[model samples]
Target: MNGPAQLADLLGMASVQRAGVALLVGSVGLPVIGVVIVGLDIIPVRFAMMHVALLGAAIGMLTGLDPALCGLVACAVAGAGISPLARTPESLSGAMGLLMSLAIAAALLVLSIAGVNASAAFSLLWGSILAVRVQDVLVLAALAVVVPALFWWRRRDLALLLHDRELALVSGVPVRRLTLVLLVLVAVAVAGGIRLTGALLVDALTLLPALAARRLGHSLTAIICWAIGIGITVNLIGFLVALALDLPPGPVLVLAAGAAALAAHLIPERRNTSWHASVH
Candidate 1:
């Protein structure tokens, strides 16, 4: 069959449809969350949550429970536990490092004790979009709505907080409480992204687009719009290209996002340099 036919057949499968919806939701939601994450300089928290999710998945495998649910709960707990430490960049970094180490070690211990197959463990790390369940799609869909709604509702506070936490606090923005809420939201979102794209490449949907959009946009709102637009574009292209090439979508998606970020970074520099030379 031709590539389009093959893609159509794949899309016809219920599982693939679920996977596509999950990705679509993620493409929209993750970037909005990424704005807060990038603004607050809390990138380490996402990495820590990824490891916690893996530990949760390991425990689920041992206990015969749904790994996705276990992972989500684990991430939420970790996010809450670490919220107090988010008072400063240094504390947050140190706490995240400690959490990552502990989570990964615990995950290894659980896997070894249970004699879980390496492939099963590896699945949590690499993810398989084709294996996405309906529940996963629903969770992503809900988050897609809730996160953007929260951002819209709290736009003023978030804007102030992102600009400068101390300034936000001075303006009576309830920095600590808002930070805690954002962290929890980020944790849950990261877990959902992991379910679709795996721990290692969730950033393709989350961070990379935000980073690329930053290059293209000057204001917070503009950056967010660009991030969402970039995320949707890359995700769709990557999914279709993966279908065409008979490849895994996760890595291809990452590559596409990375390429977009690279172009976003370099193109502006080249344009500026050309402009400078012409002026000189």
Candidate 2:
């Protein structure tokens, strides 16, 4: 999914870059989680994570939302009637919250109405890395391109809105429209990433790189570079280790991300560097 233009965009859009990193990590993280569960002698991680991932992916694709977004909506709305949208216009967020809640309710109702096998539905939640097909990779690649580019194309506004919605509004940043688009975008990216990593671990990919970037670098560009580098390392290494050891990839990827985060914390950061600009 990633190409030259998008790579260039990563130089600017921190959020999109962050999601790109998550994409890389989740692509491997889900399988790693499965391996960890197996190693710990817990229940078959595959069944739970796999089913959940599949269900989330299916729902997302069906609804034209990213599968990752679908899971977030379903889980979050099911738990609380919230949109997971903040740092933006409240009105737009409120609308998103309502829509997400309604959508999830519709999905659940459909599942209930169709009398679908709960077990089958669960597969979307947690998925199998061992069985990951080329199609999955292609889908992820496409999302990797679309997700990051979309955010990058609008990064300045997104940064302003997230860090300071009021200021952004006053500055003519289309706060309401931006908020709605961002809310939906976040949902979609999360849903797509979750397909590879599983919901439990997808957040790691989404959040970890940004967190690491906060500490290690000065410019947003530098941070994104580190974030993507960290993500790539985790995904590639985790997958290989899992394959060699006959382990699941999802939990392993999470562990890898965690380890990278810990290392970032422990490592000496660049001397005398400062955070260039706050999100606002």
Candidate 3:
């Protein structure tokens, strides 16, 4: 009887371990997918556009129209800069330099004229998604669905563009039209995710999974699926941790991503010792 009771207890402990492992695996999937969608141009908007003065645009959209459309405006601004500034490599580092300057100047001007609170403007630009409401989740869920679905409907065109823009255009992939669509999709994700993660770190949300997927993902499709799973899991777990620690969700989420990246790197190679044939 004693031995049977001990065995049952051990089995229960094993079950717990299995559950814990599943949760961790799921958490690892969140940022991976979010980043992949961004890389795939499923979400063109980055937290990049949540500038001081841009709050007015978002505010207007929030009040009347859809927040995603407002984000599209910002994405357009980013798109305009990308080819001329960000893609230049030489100019990329400083691309935000002038824009930041202009944005600051404009923000100051608005402050003088409209008397918007400095903190409010800053908050809108940065955002706080730590303790989000259901409404926020709904909006994010919708964008998550719409943006990815659109990309799926036209994955070939996007793949071509990413692989080689000139080739895509030559192949009659409607490069300009699709590029515009992709940028808009990004804006939607950026705007939606900003409520939780803030503006500056949007790239991290979109990039982390891509980094992981690149390592574990054998093919593009597999990479994206795995990436989304990572993004969603990290986000949920990070939010919970942020709640527990009384920390900022944005930074907490980023820290989670960094940890996962480190773990991925630290993970041991599975090659057997017997197979250690050093050709070098």
User: What TM-score fits each model?
Assistant: 0.90, 0.61, 0.65
Rank list by TM-score: 1, 3, 2
Per model, state how many residue pairs clash.
0, 40, 21
Model 1 misplaced regions, further than 4 Å: 112-119, 267-280
- Which of the two, 2 or 3, has more TM-score? 3
In candidate 2, what residue range of length 10 has the lowest lDDT sum?
Answer: 31-40
Return the lDDT, model 2, position 198.
Answer: 60
The list of candidate 2 runs beyond 4 A from truth reads 1-106, 267-280
What local distance difference test score does each model get?
0.83, 0.50, 0.52
**Pairs of residues at least 3 apart in sequence or in different chains that clash in candidate 1:** none
Q: Which ranges of candidate 3 are over 4 A from the true structure?
A: 1-47, 52-101, 131-135, 265-280
RMSD of each: 5.4, 11.6, 10.0
Query: How would you encode candidate 2's per-residue C-alpha lDDT over 1-280 as one tens digit per residue?
Result: 3355644654356543343444454443222222212222222222232333344545765566755445645543322322233343444335444554555556566566656555555566565554444545555565556545544576566555544556677878886565444334444444455556665666455555545554675643455456666667766677555544546667877787788778788978666333225321
Looking at model 1, residue 167 earns an lDDT score of 78
Q: Which ten-residue region of model 3 has the weakest summed lDDT?
A: 271-280
Model 2 Cα shift for residue 174 (angstroms) = 2.6
